[model samples]
Target: MYAPTPESTGSSVDDRPAVERLRHGDRDALTELYQRHGASVYWNAYGVLRSRPDAEEMTADAFLTLWTRRREVQLYGVSVLPWLIVTVKNLSRNRLRANQRRTADSLDAADPPSARASAEELAALDEAMALVREVVDRLPAVDQEIFRLCLVEELTYKEAAAALGLKHGSVRNRLSRMRTRLQSELGPRS
Candidate 1:
C-alpha cells in the first residue's frame, strides 16, 4: 500500500516539456525530474528490497536509466512517477536475480555433489577404485592378507591381529600405512 508524498498530492503541470528538455540534454530538466519522482522511485524499490542500501542503489540506477534513455522518455499524463516506479521494479528484479544466481553458485561450489552422481564422477570413482584394487593386489604377501582381512572382511584391527598372530598395534599401524599409500596413489578426492 503506497501513500503519495506531499509533492505527489497536489495538481502539477504536465511533465512532457521537461522530458523534452531532458531529451535536448538539459540537466535542469533532469534535476527537476528527479525532484518530482525520486521519492516514489526510492520507496518503490524499498518496498521490494526492504534494505536501505539496495533501495538507494536502485534509486540511483533508475535515475541513471532516465538520463541515459532521455531521448525516449515517455510519461502517463502529468507525472513521471509511474515510469520511475516501473523502472525501479525492473531494477529490483534484476538485482534479486543476480543475488540469487550468486548464492546458487556458492551453494553448488560448497556442495560438490548433486542428488545423484553425474556420469563423469561415477566413471572417475570407478577408475580410482580399479587403481586402488591393483595397488592392493600388488601388496607384499603378509600385507595383502592383512588388507583383505581388515577391509574386505570388515574385521576389527584386534580381530585381524588375533587371526594373523600379530600385535594389535602392529595391525593398526599396518592398516594406517596401507591407507596412506592408497590415498597417495589415488591423488585427491573430488
Candidate 2:
C-alpha cells in the first residue's frame, strides 16, 4: 500500500525535469520527487535494513544526498530511481555495519576476555584460518582483488567494479565463483 498523494497516480513519470529543477534549487521539485519516489525508496531501505526507523532515516538521507549532490547527480536513462535505490542500499548497509560494530564493542566491554581458550582450541582455530588464507591465496590475482574488495572491504559490487575498473557483471560473476570455490575448499572433508 502506498500513501495517497496528488502526485502518486500510479503511472510512469519522467524524472529528468524534477532532477533539473532540483539542480536549480527548486524546493517544490524536491518535494515532487519525494512524493513520487519516497515510498519505493523507503521500501528498498527497509528490504535491506529490516528496521522501520532505520529505513525511514535512510530514505530521508538518500533524498538529502540527492538534494545536496544535485549538481553531481547522474541519471540512468532519464530516471533517478536507480541512483535512489543504490543510495538507499549503501546507506542501509553502512547503518547495519555501524550497529554491528557498536554491538560488538559493547559486548567486548561488558564481557572482558578473562577466560582464555585452551592451547589446543587456539591451535585449531589458527590452523583453520591458515587453511582459509591458503585457499584464498590460491585464487587468481583478479579474483583475490575481487575477494578483498567485496568480502573484506564490504563494498557493493558496483563500487568494487568502479574501484577496480571492471564491469559490474564481471565483478559479480567473479565474486560468485570465488565464493563457491572457497566454500568447496573449506567445507568439511570426507
lDDT of 2 by residue, 52-130 (tens): 9989988986787687668888888867888888887877776677567667776887754776678999998999889
What are the runs in model 2 whose C-alpha is more than 4 Å off?
A: 1-11, 111-190
Q: Candidate 2: TM-score?
A: 0.55
TM-score of each: 0.52, 0.55
- On TM-score, the candidate that comes out on top is 2
In candidate 1, which residue pairs clash? Answer: none
Please report how far candidate 1 places residue 144 from its true position, in Å. 65
> Model 1 Cα displacement at 121 (Å)?
29
lDDT of each: 0.75, 0.79
Please, what are the lDDT tens digits per residue for candidate 1 over residues 1-190?
A: 9787656641365778888888999999989878877777888899988889989987886786677667766777876677778877876765665566667776887753565788998998899879988999888755775786677555667755654546899889998999999989877666
Weakest 10 consecutive residues of candidate 1 by summed lDDT: 4-13
Cα error, candidate 1, residue 20 (Å): 1.6
Give the distance in Å from residue 39's predicted Cα in candidate 2 to where it truly belongs: 0.3
